[model samples]
Target: MGIIQNIKKNIIAKAMDKRKAANPFNPEYSDNFQLPPDAAEDQNNSHYFSVHDLKSRQSLYMRLALRGGSAPTEVWFVYRDGDGTVYMNERDHISKGESIPAAVECVEGGKKLRFTYTGPVKKGRLTDKGYVPDGNSGDTMVELDGNFSGLTDTFEFSRHMATEPVARALSREKFTKEFRAALSEHHQVHYEQSGTVTGSLKLGNREIVFDKLPAFRDHSYGKRDWNYFDRYVWLVGLLENGDFIHNSLIRYPAVTEIQAGFYKTGGKTLCVKNCTSMDELPVTGGVPEKFSYTVAYEDGSVRRVSCSLDFTVPFVFGGGTYFVNEGVSDFTVDGIKGRGITEFAFNADSSRWTRK
Candidate 1:
């Protein structure tokens, strides 16, 4: 049985390698890929965003099914105060192609956490330039009812369009179109931003109010396949000096190459830039004790940051483990010092691949 299982694993790995070779990571791909009207209308395409508040020591995660009716939308609410106690809850509902409307009525509740979309999704103006989410007034309004109460002061990042002539031309090719369409059946375009959370949270029946808490939110739209990457690391930080940073590193087994996430930084709200490197301590039991990395913009400027774990909670889905860690970190940008919350996620699967 062991020999047979090993053979099966070897075959799967070889097939994955071939696929990765065919879909090599092109740094400029996203910069060049164009979404056709039909592609943009794909019901399978979806959007997801999450917010983490360090001051309040809580986080709210949400995902919307933009067009698809096959599955339900999900929300995850988490809270971790200084007392070492943690609270979390997950909720899901079938929208049946009424995502925009359903969002206004969606609700998830538990003893420690509860959330609801209290209002309509202020639709952003669609332009030939691209979709611009209406400011906080135009964005979706969500009411967190359980551990925390208050509205999220969310912000949207600038969109990066495909500019290379070659990429643009290839994007219109039959193969490219078909490939993207197929991938969309499982993936979507991802966008994110940072924000401030205002409201109060309950600590063992005691109500604590926060005037302003540092927060971060992200949104992705399209078909999403969580298993696309063998593993990945996502770290987000919001500093005391009103700065925010996000770093992600994804490993695709097919290409044996690592696709780094766009490193972003700025005051309260940050913009996305290219990342150079990500270094971290060895992971044990699916958690990394510490991490450090650097990000560079198009102008050749760079920034460095480091973080150490404070606590972590494990979330499992689709037979995979995601360890979300909250940590303390220091950011040095242009000789300035700032501190904030740093979080990391690691996806682990011991049997996915076999070593020779």
Candidate 2:
């Protein structure tokens, strides 16, 4: 089974990197910068902005999208980390038309991205307030607008490389002492808990799907040892399809709160997590820059699986673009349909592609 789950994830990633170096946020996170300026080549094809600021500047942003030039279109991807912190992924309408996603033809570019729709929906708020030299370090904020309206179309395309360049922007005691010395050398090792992902997406008019647990390497973020990693989870994402996030590590003081669940299947693939309401994960129409989503997972028994998406691209940064309410997601959970998509990528952190 994948080499005994990579030898039990290298013995639990070395005992969670030594309990993340005795907690207390690992001496401010440790520094290791160097590797920023390299990938660039998007004159104006709509949107694509890969970014990274390791060595403790603590940054990692990404965006990608594709929409109907023809054949199985719609894709989106977004990943954020340098303080602003956001994470979005999408895939829209493509079950039988499957084609356009060789990573969006590995992006050579023809160019097509303008933005400006204003039909309604646009709002933001997320604060567990915990970072930047304060007393907390959970940080989050998302909102976007630049202005366009007239409406043009080429479908959209992106990969990110407008010339790398963004080495270090830290200072909050150098990104909390280099993210607590890199989580105390990544928690001494010993990791486990693998499996969970669902799918269903098609965004031109709108289609959605989700199953949760995208980034799970073991118990913390995946849940098991008093779960909910340090709290700071928020929700309101809607591009068209896909929304079921969970990136692990919690237990020490506990702080995880971006809870979600709205994806159903009778074939034994369900996710319902303590609900209050998101209308079960709906997402209305009229929004499409290009998006898709498909995720599946089952850890209660044997093993079930699903994850099929093309792409949905979107990006800008700081000033705001991140990815939110692109199509006005409605919401669902028991019937299996949580949705959103616009541009997203996952190969296990491609280093925030500057194109490289």
Candidate 3:
């Protein structure tokens, strides 16, 4: 099953690359909110930004998802300290506009995107015994003001990544009402860029300042219903040699899945043809472990990326149905040092993490 599926995946990936070359990703999408054709149903638009202050071994992250229907708009902010303490702030009910996302204050379209948070934070740390919380942090207000400025042209996952595997699996699977619901949760288009984030973060009066630190930004828009997914894992990081790497494996119900990612180095960006053992990547909360991945490029050439988790910030959204566990990581590819994040997501209600 894996062999045949992988063959088809490669073929589809090749076609995707051709289509992408012909249709060059539009720049306007970097800051624009686009609604899918099924606009009346479960459409959603979201923006994510992350910057690792390597010097301090800390980071600040933001995610804002605007959804259709009674689903509330979400604005989440996370700050990770050098000592591994995680501070999180989130608002589930917020007013948003048709073309404007709430909480993400845009200074300029793709060039500079700004985000801020002003609220009490929940403090926690994943330790040897398990997760330890500070009991709501007792009125501790966390404030953040940060902006991301792009360092490269945006990469469109829709164009370069393979979605045919999922489409083909869905075509053959019985589309029960449950399957349709799961399909609705998929995000059809995704855009991202490597950049720098600069701003200031305050935790009760002790302030940490950010000044042009290496970062990453992502924008995804389409219909999304979190109830459909089982789990997902992705890693994005920047090398000292000015290279950036991103790869993800998203799993859904009944053998449906998608693998998408690219590598940018030596002034060229290449699509990853396949990744090995992604389904087996461990997601653990104890002692901050590490993992390595072997990825084959379009030419079938492979490279090893060793990633180690330095610290993580965990967040739950979608009314307790979804969780995104993100970590600041140190990555080494061919002996070059890099730093960024690795995200592990779960449908909490149906996840092993929750069961444990």
Best by TM-score: 3
Which 10 successive residues of model 3 have the least lDDT summed?
A: 93-102
Cα lDDT of model 1 by residue, 69-88, tens digit = 34444434444444434444
> Order of candidates by lDDT, top first?
3, 1, 2
Ranking by TM-score: 3, 1, 2
On residues 67-159, what C-alpha lDDT tens digit does candidate 3 reach at each position?
A: 766555667677778887877764445654432223675677767888877777778775864446677466568778888898887887766
1 or 3, greater by TM-score: 3
Model 2 stretches with alpha carbons more than 4 Å out: 2-5, 24-313, 316-332, 336-356
Best by lDDT: 3
Q: Cα RMSDs of all predictions?
A: 14.5, 22.4, 4.9
Model 3 per-residue lDDT at 81: 84
Clashing pairs for model 1 are: 31-162, 32-162, 45-222, 46-221, 46-222, 47-220, 48-220, 49-218, 186-223, 187-223
- Model 2: lDDT equals 0.24
Q: lDDT values of the candidates?
A: 0.41, 0.24, 0.71
How many backbone clashes does every candidate have?
10, 121, 1
